[model samples]
Target: MSETQNFIILGGSGAGLGVAHSFLKHIEPELRKLGKKYHLYIIDSSSHFFWNTGSPRSVVSAALLPAEKLFAPIADGFKSYDSSLYTVIHGTAVSWDVGGRTVTVELANDQNTQTTLPYYALVLATGTRTPSPATSLHGDHTITKAAIEDLNKKFASAVSVIVSGGGPTGVEVAGEAGHFLNGSAGWFSSRPSNPKAKVTLVTNRDKLLPVLSKPRALTAEIYLNQVGVDVVYNVSVVSSTTDADGKTTVHLSNGEQWTADVYIPAWGITPNSSYAPADLKNDQGYIKTNHATLRAEAAGPRVYVAGDVGDYSRGGFHNLYATIPVIVANIKRDLLEAATSSDGSDSQPNEPDRLFTPNNSETQAVPIGPRGVGAVNGWGLPSFLIWLVKGRDYMIRNVSATVNGNMV
Candidate 1:
């Protein structure tokens, strides 16, 4: 047998986990056949995978969904695997030397230092980050839980709240908060009533979902209204500041200013690709990935990419899921074919059967205050169907399956 092949997967979220688990599941047997040994390393700053799909509702009212339901130990997903097969590192990848096949990881420790690891294959899947701390889970799920709890406390007795961005996160949050503050019942009616509370959503785009056509996009705005969420369009947030008193003030593109007790920004996502090499990145700092093979051309041998951090697709769950197998396959094939290479060098892996084509069609299921709206392949989905499929429990029940790689 040859030296143990080390596979380093940076980012332990949905896309990263999928790549790691799927690779771990199938690679060992294939490597054994090739007289090779391998080990997988999963790296991330967070120990748990926060089921952020449920954040809109979860943030509004914990009574509707408990904090425990939104987070699960990521390491536990691989409990069935032998401990010798993989190692889970709680840390952040700060940099990587593609030429050296080493990644610099800033460990989640009290000491202020970083560690490096040698790898045969490096998978970049750190995903993206929202500007506002309240909008996304970073560091750890526990810290995110605390932020949500604090946000709820600030808005509990408030009369008004403003959410920036008309994207799914903003739209959904506005709808959920609107329903609760206005005393509308969702999963539970035990939420304390504050019928006078106003929830508003301000979007820079002319339409709610700019990705979809007029009539289809109008569905989101219409549903938001039904839930008492005031939708404001064609507006950009100039600046937002919070006072020491916990009140927030926002300046809009229309030269209008609005002050609210709570301000939530879900405007945009910045790809978490700081550690990726500049030559492998696009204009937006997102790693430039081969659409079909999911390989990073300039990153040299065995560097693959998956999920939002990559520039191959417009960033979505389906695209991420589709890219996983291509990455894993290319990695396996590269290793198999490169066994005889003098030095670690790119084989220019192109697995025809594992090619991934990004789906350009607009497809999404967006929940609005317990009910929902969605469109797939130019066809609108019924609210009840959206409710039945995704809105009911925000698919929290599938968190286990998702983490365990069953859904991948």
Candidate 2:
């Protein structure tokens, strides 16, 4: 074994960068103490780490959170670290082979470079990709930014807006639209004094926030009702057409047609797992990950999975924190074992200290307008608390720390 090693983190969004930050911030010093070195590479489709948690709010009004705040340069975030320590690849992984310990990346520019990178360890954090309007998990973020701007413009002119998909994103977007456009976020707005935004959230489920309990879901629906946002249940957006006038006619499953100024669909997700090994994924295309180790064992050694792309647990905000630490610990443990060994081979530890056992309990927060609903470990939290936790700011303030590796 050489004195140096290479680590590749695919998907520079939340989970990908989080692993990079965690590994570097926590492991670099330990490696240095042993005179060992490693180079980290972060690859992603976007050059920026979008603070997507604030998307619902950013979509409503850019003044609240400017693009500068929403999109942080991924390269600059790691500038403080040594120049040779890591490289940020602004590209997408087109294919990877765990058996060969190599991944192929297609560059994101006109030159169209395809590079095959070898790594001592590989972390798959590509996450899921939703359609155009729902940009949170979209791979091409520049397109997402532009699409969102167009959406905001359409939303500004359209008094009647349709938010298709009753999931967290759809409901939250509807909430933000209703909260701000109708009343300027209860603060200030350059929008017309009385924008009177008519926002409707459509879902195939019977109630809003299907993740929440029936009673908790009722609270969300009640809040939307109080804010004048209509909730259409058990209905799906079958198809949509936009005319030259920018008016969208949405066709529903029930043969109902509605014309709205804006149509935003937050449903339908395609896991960005195409580049991953076939054996790593489940029937749904999400990577099948070990809950205890966060590794796709079929991918062979030092290959782990994290965040929404993995099927170990439901992808949630806190789940990233829960899962990445286990991955980092396992990585760190392996690195430490090799560093301390007489020969460069892993000295496996017996303890399960690095494992994380996923459970059926829920920990999620969905804010609607100003009020919200949340639960942690099956216990419901108060609406105001949920609002305080996310609605007030959408955790925009934490994006920098998250990108820079402080909050993993």
Candidate 3:
């Protein structure tokens, strides 16, 4: 209905889609019971929803599945919803006016016309921007696929492969390369001296998986080294130059230079909060939200944020999962109060906003090739369980179901 409240969602990746799915699964039912009507506008730069957790493995090993599987249409996630209430806009939000409750988005095309959309409530799920394999921020799936194909080709011919960043992404990428090039009966071991790709991992941290415990970190490095990945720690790549012949000379901060055929930056996080109000953001440009309520610390219209874009002390898929339900609950509460307040003659008392307490517990699974390592909370897990839980398909199948609106 034209009179219905417009609840706009920004971003369509893991955190964004999580909120969208929650709206359809939880918020819609409550609204129906209250005889309320609302519209969900999901605006994203990318038309397709990318499974970020599986991206690193997918780019390094495209043979695992089709490119289409890596990136699926965002609309497919809301197949069960009524088309009238769900609107998917593929564009970039360039400006916003919290005072006016309107956001201007620059459409993705040569024209680049700026279109303004007014909203009753807003959910900022834009998240952070990172290089491909960790995350694709450009929102162009075609370009991402093409880049992946090119990388695969380079991997095939590269003699020395350099992966910078020892985070989960870099660790996994190095592992995939090792497995692909030197697995059982692999080219590296098969030829033994044919000058196959020598995979090297460089990180500024003292150890891999810096967030994990010492035992888990050491185990991860041991596993990767077991698979033929040269793990270099306490060193970061300062700059790299690729020659005409495709040979890359990588200069490290330690004043050491190494030559490689392929270089991949699988680290770093750049927040995507340009469209957010400055007062609601932190020094790092990430939106500041109440730890319990997941509500933006603002005095104007009610605003909420989640995912990498939110300034949580620790960031990961685990944090996103913990905050999604809280955000949904708070939104539903606001909507209910607003609906009831409309019928009041003189005045309606405001209801207290629900606070969301995030669970600080952490869990990580990093698989290198067939065998991997992981930790749940502070306890270390076996390699078999790591592979079983995530290494099998990098949880792509499960994430796909989530994207498709399946219960799993």
Evaluation by lDDT, superior candidate among 1 and 2: 1
lDDT of 1: 0.80
- TM-score for each of the candidates: 0.93, 0.92, 0.91
Judged by lDDT against the true structure, how good is candidate 2? Answer: 0.80
What are the per-model numbers of colliding residue pairs?
Answer: 0, 1, 2
lDDT tens per residue, model 3, 340-386: 66674123337666665655555787987787877778677888998
Per-candidate alpha-carbon RMSD to the true structure: 3.3, 3.5, 3.2
Supply candidate 2's per-residue lDDT for 66.
55
Task: Judge candidate 3 at residue 233 and give its lDDT.
Answer: 84
Worst ten in a row by lDDT for model 1: 185-194
Expressed as tens digits, the lDDT of each residue in 193-218 for candidate 2 is 45476778999989877677888888
Report the C-alpha displacement of residue 290, candidate 3, in angstroms.
Answer: 1.0
Error of 3 at 407 (Å): 4.8
